[model samples]
Target: MKATVYVTIKQNVLDPQGSAVQGALHSMGFDEVGKVRIGKYLELELNTTDRAEAESRLKAMCEKLLANTVVEDYRFELEG
Candidate 1:
């Protein structure tokens, strides 16, 4: 099984890196761009074939290490 995780800052949280990227884009003449939020994308390969078990473990992984629940949100997808 394959799992993919996306981790991003929460809506109410401040994102300095995102802001810096937005500013750089504007300076590069990409004025049409507005707000930008930076995030993380992770892909994992699992040894288990059980979809339910994989999902359960994935969620736990996110809560325990993948995301900072206080300031970040995470979502994952599973693929066979």
Candidate 2:
């Protein structure tokens, strides 16, 4: 199975990197760009075929390492 994970900053947190990118874009004539937030995408391959176990493991992975629960949120999709 393949797992695709997306990790993003919490809405209440400040995203400096995202802000910088937005600023650069505006300077380059893309002035319509508004609030920007940065995030992380991750892909993982697992040997298991069971959806239940995969979901449990994936949640543990996100909570323990893939995302900082205090400032980030994560969600994932699984495919065979």
Candidate 3:
């Protein structure tokens, strides 16, 4: 199975890197761009075929290492 994860900053947190990118875009004539946020994407392969087990393990992984629970939120999709 393959797991695709997206990790993003929580709405209440500040994102300096995202702000910098937005500023650069505006400077380059993309003035319509508004509030930007940065995030992480991850792909993992697991040996199990059970969807329930995969979801459980993925959630654990995100809580433990893939995402900082204090400031970031994560979601994932599974594929075979």
Clashing pairs in 2: none
Candidate with more favorable, higher TM-score: 2 or 3: 2
Q: Any runs in candidate 2 off by more than 4 Å, and if so which?
A: none
Order the numbered candidates by TM-score, best leading. 1, 2, 3
Native-referenced Cα lDDT, model 3? 0.97
Report model 3's TM-score to 2 decimal places.
Answer: 0.96
Using Cα atoms with residue i matched to residue i, what is each candidate's TM-score against the true structure?
0.98, 0.97, 0.96
Who wins the TM-score comparison? 1
For every candidate in turn, the CA RMSD to the true structure comes to 0.5, 0.6, 0.7
> What is residue 19's positional error in candidate 2, in angstroms?
0.3
Model 3 deviation from the true structure expressed as Cα RMSD, one decimal place: 0.7
lDDT of 3 by residue, 1-80 (tens): 99999999999999999999999999999999999999999999999999999999999999999999999999999999
The number of clashing residue pairs in each candidate reads 0, 0, 0
Residue 9 C-alpha lDDT in model 2: 99
